[model samples]
Target: MKKDLWIGGEYRSAASYNELKNPYNLELLAKIGSASQEDVRLAISAAHQAKTMMVEMPAFERAEILEKVARFLRDDLDECARLIAMEAAKPLKAARAEVNRTIMTYTFAAHEARRIHGETVPMDAAPGGQGSLAFTVREPLGVIAAITPFNFPMNLVAHKVGPAIAAGNSVVLKPASQTPLSAYRIAEYFHTAGLPAGALNIVTGSGSKIGEVLKKDDRIKMITFTGSPEVGRYIREHSGLKRVTLELGSNSAVVVDEGVQLNKVIPRIVNGAFAYQGQVCISIQRIFVHESIIDEFTEQFVSETRKLKAGNPLEEDTDISAMITRGDVERTKQWVDEAINNGADLRLGGSAEEGIFQPTVLVNVPLNEKVSCEEVFAPVVHINSFRDFSEAIDLVNDSKYGLQAGIFTNDIHKALQAAKKLEVGGVMINEIPTFRVDQMPYGGVKMSGMGREGIKYAVEEMTELKLISFKTE
Candidate 1:
């Protein structure tokens, strides 16, 4: 199958296309048109041209269009989920779940479109004078560049594009090369939903080539990206005077208290660690169990991990699937080998065949090792025991990335205290850090990322506030 580029509300072909192979079996799935520098320029120009109409369109119209998009997505739920599973190697079950979340995300955006409210300033209350009226109104930023990642391609793209459109702004999207089909399908939805031409244009190609154009383009007012810290920093440094919202990397940690029920929490921990083969940025990478319950937790955790069925993603019974690529599996194995070489105990599976890497659990991994300290972005986790709650909080905070952390404790005081003390964007009490709903504020701090990504929060990021005042005589 061949997929063309969607530029300025039209599907067109390019000189060359990038082959999109199924990561699980390396089968050819489709070919996406490779966007050239000129194509990138044209997309930006088209968005700029359409910005006036988009910004002037009534909020109600935008909301209505988004509602239509949501209905279409729901109608095509199965097909969308299957596409995600095929392109990204996400399990069919997990992919279906993502489709549901994406639908919720768009639905939330539809609601947020009408709720872009600004506050009224009490100019008269101040020492100024009477008869002075002041208020603020939210306005759309002209052209937003949305660069999305391969993981959660449909939803993450919605997190950016949905809000941009809802806020009455035009978007130029650059989806991940590895999985651009989902993005294309989304653009098609926008087109069929009567979204104005150039309101949503998609360019697919090399990241460096397309990203440089997006960064340098003067027409792009804001860039919302979800990817690595390296690329996020580069975008920040190069995109002078342009607004940016980055959702980057993380080495998320989860703490289990002594009083917690092992049966209740172990399954959640297992899901958090190995879901989507642990490709998630906030997938639990470190587990700090109280020393009193460490042995039991480890035994139960290994037993649960052993039951995961890793095989073809299309199979509904498959609990695990291949990683995005064989290379990622190799890189993950390298990290596991390094941890073992540095005295970490390999308690369970540590082998890779092709793109499939068995879910791995490690114990006694030194704090400084890459597997413990860095964003592994794989299906491997390190388990450690902490005698003191303060010590567990310290271990969680020691990493440079402060995305999210989870604490499973029966004690309310301890949960609240950890909530206050953990240096992260979010702290989940009695829930895994991986817990996230579609409408909640989701982002990170430090190297993890900047800005929030819940539908409402993202709409705020995609727009600006303009204060308008009238002085009555």
Candidate 2:
């Protein structure tokens, strides 16, 4: 299939093109344009034109346009889901679910756009204003550069594009080169939905070239990126005087308190650790179990991990799929071997065959091991014993990545205490760290990221507040 860059509502060929391979079978899926610096500049210029048109669009009309786009997504759900599964190596069922969630995100943003209103402040209480009125309204932040990751390509793109368009801001999207097809489809839907030309642009290529251009461009007003922490830091360093919202990597933790039921908790933990081959930033990397239940939890967790079917993502029965690439698999194997060398006990599924690594669980993991400290974006889980809830909380908070952590506890006081003490963006009770809704404020606190990505919250981030003052004598 031929895939080209989308700029100003038209498909444009690039100076160079790259092949995208399916991770499951290592087959060439399609050839997509590798954007050049000139292409990036053209995209930014298109976004600037879109921004000018967006500000003039009536808020209700923008909401109507997004609503139409959501309808188009729902109509083409099956095709979109299949494209996501084929391109991103996501399981068929998970890909379908992701499409559903993406539709919901757009619909929610459409509804939110209608409700974006200003609040009036009574100025009579002010020191110098007796009969004056003050109010604050939100305006678009002009052009937004949306850089998305390969994992959850459809949903993450929706998280950025839905809000930017709903808030009346133009966006230049740089989808991961590995999975750019799904994003291109979304851009097509926007075009069909009557979005003005240049309202949304998609440029696919080497991240380094396009990312640097987007970061340094003065015309781009905001940068919304979802990727690794290393790249996020680079964007912050180079982006001058522009708003930035980064959703970076995480080494999220899950704590099992003594009062929790193991059978109920084990399945959730296993799913969180193994889903999408554990590529999710909020996927559970470390498990701090109460010493009383560590032995039993480890046994059950290993037994469950052994049951997962690691095979082709297109297969209906495959519970776990291949990693993003063979290199990722090799790196994960090395990390597992290094942890074992450091005295960590490999309890279950520590072998790698071809591109698919076995879902692994490591017990007696030392505190300083790479698997425990680093963001292992693979199908691996590290378990460490904690003497008490306080120690467990401390271990969970030890990482600079404060994305999301969970406490499996029935004790009300312990749950509340964890809510206060866990230095993370989200705290889940009686569950693993993988719980997320499309409406919640979903982002990290520290190195994990800056700012949030839910529909309402992202609209807030994509807009700027302007104060309007009125006086009557």
Residue 281 lDDT, candidate 2, scale 0-100: 87
- Name the top lDDT candidate: 1
lDDT of 1 by residue, 176-225 (tens): 99989999899889888889999999999899999999999899999999
Q: What would the TM-score be for candidate 1 when compared with the true structure? A: 0.99
What are the lDDT scores of the predictions, listed in order? Answer: 0.93, 0.90
* Candidate 2: stretches off by over 4 Å: none
Question: Could you tell me how far off, in angstroms, the CA of residue 143 lies in candidate 1 after the best superposition?
Answer: 0.3
Q: Pick out the ten consecutive residues of candidate 1 with the lowest summed lDDT.
A: 124-133
Which regions in candidate 1 have their CA more than 4 angstroms from the true location? none
